[model samples]
Target chain A: MSPLAENSGPDIIAAVIGLGSMGLGMAQSMKRAGLDVVGYDITPAAVDRFVADGGRGAATPAAAAKDADIVVSVVVNGAQTEAVLFGPQGVANAMKPGAVFISSATMDPAVARDLAQRTEALGLHYLDAPISGGAAKAARGELTIMASGSRQAFDTARPGLDAMAAKVYELGDEAGKGAAFKMINQLLAGVHIAAACEAITFAAKQGLDLDKVYEVITASAGNSWMFENRVPHVLAGDYTPLSSIEIFVKDLGIVQDMARSERYPVPLAAAALQMYLAASGAGMGRDDDSSLARLYAKLSGAELPSSTKEPQSL
Target chain B: MSPLAENSGPDIIAAVIGLGSMGLGMAQSMKRAGLDVVGYDITPAAVDRFVADGGRGAATPAAAAKDADIVVSVVVNGAQTEAVLFGPQGVANAMKPGAVFISSATMDPAVARDLAQRTEALGLHYLDAPISGGAAKAARGELTIMASGSRQAFDTARPGLDAMAAKVYELGDEAGKGAAFKMINQLLAGVHIAAACEAITFAAKQGLDLDKVYEVITASAGNSWMFENRVPHVLAGDYTPLSSIEIFVKDLGIVQDMARSERYPVPLAAAALQMYLAASGAGMGRDDDSSLARLYAKLSGAELPSSTKEPQSL
Candidate 1:
């Protein structure tokens, strides 16, 4: 074989240690990009589905990571990420030296820094790569990644990063900056969604048709990407959880935590976070983030469309 | 001229009092539509500008309204609108019978309703037509008018409205609902603008280039129309007062008052109102609304673009 052919050979092994929405898609993308990808998940169905999509299934993190060149953690939170990397039977213990870990979760920057320190001590590279774009983008291998790490780590993880992300922002040579950027992005996303819901609900209260309000706002300066994307879910009365209310609860909670630590007053983000918390507590946690409109419906005594029957009439 | 052409002659007289940004352009659009438009302003220079733009000059609202078929109040706030309409030298006492009063000031719904009742009692029609789409659109006769009133009122005002607004939301056959919808629109608009400032400011604190943030966010779900529109003003450091910070202080104060009366919690709106109030307190009341970004810069110790100097670092 030519030297180029040898360089592109199947000897490059990567592991994805979680196969949830983001992770499963990422695993499939990696596999389709011609990498020998080993995916492991706590749920057998997730692993089976990944395998069905041409992924190589591994029973455990150790099984997945043994001698692997990279391990990508796309779990729910930093805690799950920590467990996958350093917990009992964790991949870090089994992965080869010089293997890089691309941690792509929206997490506290400090936690990312801590994870970086811990992984580096274990003779591994850690790339703080917090991703944006939702699951659909993830499935299409078109995610935007806000990443920070050492040059060697980026070099080691280049192929996998290129495969997974359409645009990767090289934030800095530190672990926490990527997380900071993601937090800022989350702050705007959450506030825009909540504000959109408020406008539509206020329109409803004013007796203008909600549909017309949605249409006008799209044309007006009141429009937002979140508003345009999420309001339709409210209009359709379909809460099929493209991104759940709990996700904002987590993301905004991180924002609030960051603000508190920084002694910053994030009143809008705080209010939005509370609304997401209220939505989750009201048992709409699994619903789409657009279900935030339901909170407005509750406050105004208005009705919203629902998939089944009447959705308890708000 | 033929009888049909003679019947459609420019005898349909109207006036847009207070030749500020929105008012001046609206007056021009009226003149361009072949109406006999008499423009009035307290500022002699504004009157001069109106005269230069093919508008007949009037020293007072009464003078403007004497023979006019419609009087559009495009003043600042409720107090100014009241002064323009019912003050000692107000136009209501002078407007011709069967004429329409298209009130385009952003005022409280209750205030609008009261004005409508009074205007209607005077044998004049009242359309609660609060205008949007800023100065450029106003000049192009493409402003959006959130209007509501009786069918008779709509009919009497349709010619003037047709010359001014590109799209008109006929909310209902009530006076207050148009103002209510405008207040709600302002609530979301103010909050989203402030939120955009906050997020961009936070990103700047994290050392991301503000322009890049603007570019990515415009393409991402984090963006709002306010973000895409107003942020450029901040980036250019051009606070040329397209819309002043005090506008939001008044609008959001109205929103809070209305929300409080209904016992509705509008935390995001409330937070945004305070920020605008802060901007006002910081002596930016007359600055562009995008100057709210300055508050975040002051708080976070992030350097903002210079007003006089080009943003060399960007």
Candidate 2:
């Protein structure tokens, strides 16, 4: 059946039940793609902003999700997602039967499996569709989605999926695979950024000009997406939190938990986690993820860039 | 005066002693660049290869250095370097007057400075010129040389340096800076390769098809030079040594020493060092650095591609 047919049939409207960086972007993308988007957030400003952006805004989850064809939960983690969908006055009951709920947060695979089973019991489809790409890509509808679900769920969610992501990796006809893939991506991304910071700061301490090191590394084999993206923040000394140190504190924690559960020893991931923890503990948690480079500078007593420099860190 | 004029007038012919992966490649590059290159090694087979490749092969360091303008030591480490250049029956006393010595191994920067001072006091010029690029690039006379020396030393070694290196980073007119730059490069190269291993192995553990993961990552920002170069060896399950794990064990050791002396903490480098150490301890020191992924697989109890699957891990 055509994806648009679902809305004309018994399918309800679509609810984007968060208005954070990623959620607001996805909501705009869904609206742009002609989905009936209803956005809600705990803060009135978020709801108002969604309304200002041509998406319908509601005061509460129940109001937004009532009769919704798909409720996309894009909150911080399992607890926030659970509260939004299954908490007191939550949206699960309000979402129409046969509707699909796409969860796009990076969470534990076990939690994903559990959520999938719970949503399935409600006669709803649950597609674990954790996403990548930062805020800009999200707003442009160019994110990458790692998704898994039954064929019916895939069919039910494909329109919104296509609207929200540029690349959709259909991991399997199951829930946890999406979460697993997202976790793997997170593990590498986090480690690479932290390693870039360590290497650059160490270069600086060795008396190599930070800018020269960045230039050569970017041109050489030592470069990574994270390295190319994050080292400028070090050279510019800007620590604006595009992604916060706490994000890694959370993400690498997920990696460590997964590895520990599987008896997998990931020493590099573990070491990188400790460095992020150090950054967060040093009152830079709210600063940009590039602030982790500050941890290297702090430990080495090396000088980093300051506001006198340009503001482009990423 | 032109480099040739200086070399021909009271000229010193330089012998590169080692003729291993880097040495033979460099000796050939120097020969192609028209330097009076003499290549030496303990292994007659390697010496034969150097001779066949159009380099002058000498039986002993003394014979190689008797009329040498420069002695380029390209051995494994400081000990081999010192043994070939400054030990009993060393080439230091055998070298013609006003000759230069260029140390090309990745050793402690302190050693570079010490050697430079000692050699200069002995009325010989010294240029600390550490080379980069693998054997393939080296053989094509396209290596990157991190070099530093006094004006006379630089002038003296310019002929040979120009012949062998595509990029010569004139770090400073000091001895240790070249070694420092090399240590920084090693820090990034080592960590990047290990991080790539962690990433690709994690993808495998997540059940994403290895080939698919390679294709996607190569297209994505996750790609790095090391990732692109080394991952194929893992996919093929061929661990034949190209750049061996033992190489990192030594290079990262130099980085660690550099960091420790400078009190610069390098958690990422440290973590990567441990993985190489594990690979070495597992008796894979002689295997290609790509075998690092197998170390990750063994630690995680994940199945690696076997000989039945690909026959080799190169």
Candidate 3:
């Protein structure tokens, strides 16, 4: 794959249609790269944050995309992405002919393909670009992007893409492949997080020291990226929703749907989804995914470290 | 935890009871450190190999431990450990008074405690020392050992421990605690391996490039130590039992038993265990743990890299 070019940004008008943790950062990154970047979000404060960060604020996606060469959609999932592109006040009709839309939502690949088809039919390019790295990486404009699109789509989104990402995997010349790659990532991430929680809580149940467990497992073959990152929350007895249980609940649910449609039994991903569902159902939908340890503790009467600082109710 | 001292080996007599892959390497390491190391195994060829490696070979645990100050049992599980210590011609009675028994078998903590008590009652010490790092680490004398025992036990076992292990976590001053830590590691390891297999196979089902998935994942948050290490075997269509599927079936089975006894449900481990069992039932038990990917390929009809070179029958 030819590397996408950087900083055509000086002449590009970029629209970022969401300004949550990730989107806000992307907007600032685009602006920093010298793009005339305008941002909009459902949350006014989020858009205002981007504006305060020196981005132009728009009242709607249509207004954001009206004169934009590239529109970046960074909503939560496929439905919101669809709404951003085609719902009332959507950007599709407002986008200039031949302008590109880079969709950074994680969803079923089939959904990604459908959105790309609809977007292309409107004389616009759609780039399926699902991102990795956390919000911190996003804020630093160093996200890892799994992207697939036509050559023209990549060309049009190149400036904004280079501004917001450290690594861009050009996965295919179609929209669905990047989303498929991202789903594989989500399936593993969700399962690993759940496995880490299950393992750590079982350690607690066995009366093994949690801190020592962390030290040992990290150095051992048992370690995972999620375990290393998320176990600190359990060790500190902090269940702040840095990345909430509901995120996996939604992502793994999509994996289940995608696998089901293919008539594939994804036992591990399915099991992980149920645990996330259980965590969410237990009012931890918004808690850190590591809250699975707390759920296991509550269910098994195991003594995890108690925290007076955490909220008692969801 | 006081660091166990190195290579007091010139004067120490160390016996390794079980000359398997791990045991043979450990014995060689002990011999290299100047210990008078004797080794034994049910399989005579293993003992022959150890003997060829400049160590003495014995026909029984008792014979191996007879003049030894430290007896290291590197058998598969608690039952083998128990048999080595108390079966007909076992080491507990054969070992010198005040000698230490280092049990490196992964087992239930309760069994470890029980074995420690029985050995101590016979005027010997038992160190619950479960080892990690694979055969290569063992050969390099750089294994990570999670160990616990009385001060006297640690003192007696120090030379052998230092000779063989790069990092020895002195987790507690009792026999069971080290086993507890080891089981926690196993729980996560088993689950992570199963999840990695599930993920790569699912990616294959999605028709995503397996090599690309590996490239993207190891750099992403979805990565685990297992995924990075084991996926290559899948990519090469090699299922060489580097670490067998049966290993996780056994480890996760142990985890399930441990969790169940505490009435703690480890759904992810349990789910992962089911996948390992499925892989094993499909006659991949003795195949590498990554064979779960092959199992997924079989059940879902996904085309993972295939090998005419791989065995087709159990």
DockQ values, each candidate: 0.56, 0.55, 0.80
What are the per-residue Cα lDDT tens digits for candidate 1 across B98-202?
A: 999899988889899998998889898899989899889999999999899999889988888998999998988989878887887788889998998888777
lDDT of 2 at B123: 84
Q: Weakest 10 consecutive residues, lDDT, candidate 3 chain B?
A: B1-10
TM-score of candidate 1 to 2 decimals? 0.92
Q: TM-score of each candidate?
A: 0.92, 0.90, 0.96
Which portions of model 3 show Cα errors greater than 4 Å?
Answer: A1-10, A308-314, B1-10, B308-314
Question: Could you give me the TM-score of model 2 versus the true structure?
Answer: 0.90
lDDT of 2 by residue, A1-314 (tens): 35564355433367988899999999888877777889989889999998887678888898888878788888998778788878987888888888899999899898999989988999999999998888999999999988889999998998888889999988889999888877777877888888888888877777777777776667666677888898887787778788899998999999899888877778889999999898888888888888887888888898777767445332
Model 3, B84-116: lDDT tens digits are: 999999998899999999999999898999999
User: Which pairs clash in the backbone of model 3?
Assistant: none
List the pairs of residues colliding in candidate 1.
none
CAPRI grade, predicted model 2: medium
Candidate 3 per-residue lDDT, tens place, A1-314, comes to: 11122223357899999888888888878776677889999999998888786677899889999999999999999999999998999999999999999999999999999999999999999999999887888888899999999999999999999999999999999999999999999999999998888888888887888889999999999999999999888888888778899999899999999989997888888888998898889888888889988888888987888766856443
> How well is each residue in A1-314 modelled by candidate 1, as lDDT tens digits?
33243236686888998898899888777766777788999999999998787677888898999968989998988998999898988988898899999999889999999999999998999999989887888888899998989998898998899889899988788898788878888899999889888777766665667786777678777778888899888888877778888989999999888877876668789889989999888888987888888888887775665565346323
Give model 1's share of reference contacts.
0.57
The whole-model lDDT of each prediction reads: 0.84, 0.82, 0.89
